[model samples]
Target: MTEAVEYDVVVLGAGPAGENIVDRTRAAGLSTAVVESELVGGECSYWACIPSKALLRPALARADARRVPGLAEAVAGPLDAEAVFAHRDYWTGHWKDDGQLDWLESIGAHLHRGHGRLHGVRTVAVTGPEGEHELLTARHAVVIATGSRAVIPDLPGIHGARPWTSREATSARHVPPRLLIVGGSVVAAEMATAWQALGSQVTVLVRGPRLLPRMEPFAGELVAEALREAGAVVRTEVTVEAVVRDGSTGPVTVVLEGGEPVEGDELLMATGRSPRTEDIGLDTVGLTPGGWLDVDDSLRVVGHDWLYAVGDVNHRALLTHQGKYQARIAGAAVAARAAGGSAGAGGVDTGRWGAHAATADTAALPQVVFTDPEATAVGLTLAQAERAGLRVRAVDHDLGKVSGAGLYADGYRGRARMVVDEDRQVLVGATFVGPGAAELLHAATVAVAGEVPVPRLWHAVPAFPTMSEIWLRLLETYRG
Candidate 1:
């Protein structure tokens, strides 16, 4: 028999975005239910973000220890892959999905274990482990937090060949002797670093001119240099025309566009991802042309009043953090509506602040690439700012001068660039590339988000001898 359930709000996919939404909704005094098929914590915790970084951290630690003369002798060589996996398991709590479930229960959110599908405008059907369960209606909203899946590129031999995606790369128990990476994105760079540190010779083939092309040129240059220094063969403006297994050598031989053959023990495709909207019954309600659930500024699906989309499913920013931000807003908006408030009342403004119905994503999205030398950036590129018709001034600073960089290594090489709206005196964008730059991004994020003026930011002060002090240097360079 089909079971009937009711929820003020039903969130599908308990990822960072979905979790944040439920958290905020419960705080607003709304009854919510979350449905998840896999691990409750979503991709960030188990697969994509967290685990990948875990694979890289031991490498980073080894590098750090080798830099300090006193610590160098005591520090062991590269991290053992087994030990790294053990540590990663501990961080992920051994992939226990129950921890996230408990958190949802503690927060007064109901959990449905199954795949969720939209049945109608205000209805969701859950096929749980037990039987057919129907969530009759959302008194307020139904959120689609279904994340994304990796996009597999087309190559002549790629179909038959077994290639690793982010999932396999992050969770692999052992490293291959040689690796060939397909894409030039941040994921490719990160995996290249982790595998290389674990004793794999890596060759990265990028279809684009530079790694992390989304960041500033200075930032990309620093990472490219770091990768080359760490013994990676970085190739740009190249395409993998074909791939085949060499039985004699037991390696995958990849042929580039012009018939140049590159061989590796393993192949990793870090091309990109596509929204997971194919099977979730978007057609049961309605879907847009690009396989997206079209949503307004508030993340409310257009035409379907109670259906909302969040996270990667919405086809917005792919970062887990950004997905969480969108989820929080969508959850709040739905809860408000359920509580007899207008769907748009006091809800986050999607326009000025990426509020629902807001198309201002490019203005303030933060991205970080955790390579040997990390790369972090937020907001528009100089070209983007100019295209938007804003008068922009950009300043680039060598991070070697910063106390933070000095502490990182005896001979430090890093770069920092900031784009300011000359008239507003507010940062339109910023990029930092070097060791420990990932931690340095929040100050810039806050500056851009808060619209802190250059002079005022100078007054805020970064602590002495910290990588954050580079902010002062950047500001000084801008003045000069």
Candidate 2:
């Protein structure tokens, strides 16, 4: 017999996306249930973002000490990778998903700690950790918030090879002596930086012309240079043909297409990630081409109407914050639907706000790469704007020329660029690269999101002797 439970909404995957929806739905007086197979906080909290950043902090501090005058001599020893892993473990609350579980319970959201699959259009069946079987039928909606998995390329000798993904790279106990990273995406660049700083001889093979090709060309150039400066041998514009393990003594040898073969002790594949839409019973509902659940403007899965897709499953931007945003909207939509209120109540379109909805993300999504000299970017680049047929003007400034940047380190060299709509004089995009630029991105994000006018932004003073003073210098350079 199927043990059935009812809810206003049943969210599959209690990651950040599902949790956000559960919290918001309960707040709106709607019954919500979340199902999970692993950590409640999801990938970013456990492996991707939090743990990776924790591993990078020591490298950042060491870099700061090296560059900051009077601080270089005070620093005594090298970073201990073991100690860093211990600290990462501590910050992750020691691998017990208890903290997140407690939060879910406190929020009045029922959690089924098991694998969940779609049984019907609005039904989810769960096999709990304790050998309990449960069926959940959502009176309002069933949301698929299952995230994505790292992509491993099909290369020779990849089989029987102990390759690392973002998960392994972020959680490994010990760093390998030599690491070969395939792909030039943010993950590849970041892992290269982190492992190289932690005493790994790193080499990155990229098929693109430059690293981070999706970013501004200047930013990509800067990142490439930074990787070389950090002792990473970066091979660009080369396709990888084969990766084979060298007998026993030499490192893993990776042969490039029309290029020389390079060797490393470990091969970390950072090709990319694919949406995890398989085996969750998406076919029970219906899936679009490319395995994405068909969703409408209101985040409703087409045909079924009550079904929705959120997070990476929707095949939208695979970002943690964006997924949470989708969840909040989905929760609100469910509550609105249950209240007999039109999604158009109070001029608020619940559809515009909920499951699989990433309206704001399209306009204000931000990306940051925690490289040695961190890189942060938001919105369209100059080329992107031009490609979109918008008239844009760009102004750039060097970090060393900014007073705030000067105080942070003796030989600060970084670039800050803003793309502006020539007519409205509002920023469309911004990129900042160099030490301390990661923290400087939010101000730019706020400016872009608010569509703050350039003249009005001039009055927004940056604190003196801070990295953000580059904003003022950038504006000045633009005016000059």
Give residue 477's error in model 2 in angstroms: 2.9
lDDT score at residue 443, model 2, on the 0-100 scale? 91
Supply candidate 2's per-residue lDDT for 369.
89
RMSD of each: 2.3, 2.4
lDDT, each prediction: 0.81, 0.82
Cand. 1 TM to true fold: 0.94
Clashes by residue pair, model 2: 329-353, 329-354, 330-354, 330-355
lDDT of 2 at 370: 88
User: Candidate 1, after superposition: displacement of residue 341 in Å?
Assistant: 2.8
Which stretches in model 1 have alpha-carbon errors above 4 Å?
1-3, 130-136, 246-249, 288-290, 343-351, 354-360
Q: lDDT tens digits, residues 149-230, model 1?
A: 8888888888667888988888888779999998888789899989988889999999999888877777667777777888
TM-score of each: 0.94, 0.94
Output the lDDT of residue 446, model 2: 90
Off by over 4 Å in 2: 130-132, 246-250, 288-290, 294-298, 343-347, 350-357
